[model samples]
Target: MRQYLSADKEKELIETANTLMAKGKGLLAADESTASMLKRFQSIGIENNEENRRLYRQLLLTGSKDLANYISGVIFFHETFYQCDNNGKPFREILKDNGIIPGIKVDKGLVPLAGTNGENTTQGLDNLSERCAQYYRDGARFAKWRMCSSMSSTSYNFICCSNLSERCAQYYRDGARFAKWRCALKIGDGLPSELCIRETSNVLARYASICQQVLRKFSFFSGFRTD
Candidate 1:
């Protein structure tokens, strides 16, 4: 049986989800880690210093108030959550003022799953409830956690996905109104065999269903790489 949340809470979550999915609206996922941002900057020949990162994100969040026309929400990394634009206003405030919802990425990251050949699982469950409460108080109406399932020899499994779905229920009860899971797929000649496709799809579906059962909105972000 699925757990229950108070009607008020459920209503709030549903509203947030609907706003996020408003007609012709989408989300901006600026929750990249420092290392990932560094790599991205390197690709553009820009320095990856803190000031550069702040300026770049500031440009995105405050470049124009017209962003809310198409962007309903923005997922921010921890660092970006506290960052400010040139006017000393918090990024969250800027987004809120533009009618955009502010969200936070709460996962610690992926760690290798023991007894699996390089399989990975997301961490940061410890103190998650506390973190969610604080984030909510800090102007985040929703939170994101990335749980990934990958395809590899001896690494494909549904158990990890199942575990993440179970945890999503807990997170919702703890005040997270939304969640995200990523399934990484690699495309190549003779790769992503039938087994890979079926298993990964099943896992993603299960994750979504479980989140719905708990009244939390779910987002699926799939990574496709061709090599």
Candidate 2:
């Protein structure tokens, strides 16, 4: 059941989406998981710990205010979304002050898809409404869910909105501005089997439908790939 957006909700979504699409500006993807961070840090002989993560994050956000001129928004990992810098400023607040919008990664991670060899899909749909509401309360304005095509060749990362007027509308009222999801197609012999392509589109459509219904806003996205 797709809900209707309030006047203010529609206005806010349009504004946020416009801001993100500003020419010469784009999103900074800083939402690396701890495991991902560990791999990068190890290459430089740096320890992967909370303090180090916070410091590194600080270095990125606390830079010149001009950072906002180039970076319209920042996508944060769950831990980073809740973290603070050495100066005790919350990371989200820093981004706000710097004129950058704050967003979050909501997917738990990936899981092996059934009847497929090494193919996977994302998890974390459980209790999503509660999580999105709490994230909004804490200053997150957007979200991303990592989804992958159930094909051996490629994967996807989806970003979208989530329930009840007290549920999804809360995101808009509380700051749900933008959502994103991307799925890819590959070019090769027998590549993009009709079944896999349909599977991917169906999943994306279902997820997008869910986001719009729960969040009470309009959102459209597409992702296709070659070779």
TM-score of each: 0.72, 0.78
Model 1 regions more than 4 Å off: 1-3, 153-176, 183-227
lDDT of 1 by residue, 79-171 (tens): 899899888999998888888888788778877665444456566765665666677667776566665645445434334344332233212
Worst 10-residue lDDT window, candidate 1: 218-227
Candidate 2 per-residue C-alpha lDDT over 1-227 given as tens digits, one digit per residue, 9 for 90 to 100: 44356667667776777777688988788999999999989999999998898889988887666898899878899899889978787889888887788888777887766654445566776656667767778888777665554433443332232111111211231134666544444334444456555655566555444555556554332222111
lDDT of each: 0.64, 0.65
Off by over 4 Å in 2: 1-3, 150-175, 187-199, 221-227
Model 1's lDDT to the true fold? 0.64
lDDT of 1 at 58: 92
Going through the candidates in the order shown, the clash numbers are: 0, 9
